[model samples]
Target: MKATHNPPTDVQVTPADLLRMAALYLRRHGWTQGTYYASDAPADNPTPPACVVGAIGIACAGHKVEHFADLDTDDRHTYLDAIAVLVDYLDDHYPIHLFDDDGLCIDDHTSPYSWNDDPLCTADKVIAALEGAAKEWDRLHTQGGEQ
Candidate 1:
């Protein structure tokens, strides 16, 4: 019986790298909300518009966001950690929607995807969050954290 050879996964994709990749992907292609790319989004060339998290998943998975879930668990964990960093940043600095315009707090600990999907969450903000996460990891690495 012949043994099947599994193809190697994208093991080298790190959180910091993933953040930067997602940021750049958003910058080049475009940003969207509510879905992993627009419903009418094209397959390639245009590279379909995606939200912040969508971009991260797409970037890690490469080319298509559908492939993101197919990645090994380790890879998913590493990349998801990066996404968490962005969520943390949003929960800290953004969350404009969480406010009811009366300066009252609401929906505590809401999912970051809600923030990402917020109309107030612009592409620039998402890009900044991604960059911030990358810088944050970089700082940690410099401060005796994991590499």
Candidate 2:
């Protein structure tokens, strides 16, 4: 899908905004974190899983599925492209580490935080990630404009 150049109307899209959008997209699809599994299907499949499409939607525009569902297939693909850009940006700047069921760090060799057991950790991470994205967005906007 081609990326859309249309920036969000608010001009102050936050990470939280993206997260909510992504969550909504995932919900529209059949993806649940609990049931998530690696898939070998092509990414551009018309009937892609909701979680995958949702993540792409989040990375592209911070809009809900209701809004996205209104778009044409090409537009949806463009939004997905935008999501790809967002994912690349996040991967470069705020890489998320995966943890095992026991709260042990699995992706990185670092020790797991004792606080990882607390639900607040998840909440805090979400807030912090979104805040960071907002800050980055502000920085980009202030420097020149959206990239």
lDDT of 1: 0.76
Off by over 4 Å in 1: 1-11, 43-46, 66-69, 96-110, 145-147
Candidate 2: stretches off by over 4 Å: 1-32, 35-78, 96-123, 145-147
Model 2 lDDT, full chain set: 0.45
How displaced is residue 125 in candidate 1, in Å? 0.9
lDDT digits (tens) for residues 28-91 of candidate 1? 9898888878877755544788888778877776755554467678768876788777766666
lDDT of 2 by residue, 1-147 (tens): 348677567564444445455444444543422111215445555433434334545445443343566656865665644444445445565555678899987764211222222333443443344345445555665667655
For model 2, state the Cα shift of residue 123 in Å: 4.1
lDDT of candidate 1 at residue 68, scale 0 to 100:
44
Best candidate according to lDDT: 1
Model 2, position 56: C-alpha lDDT score:
42
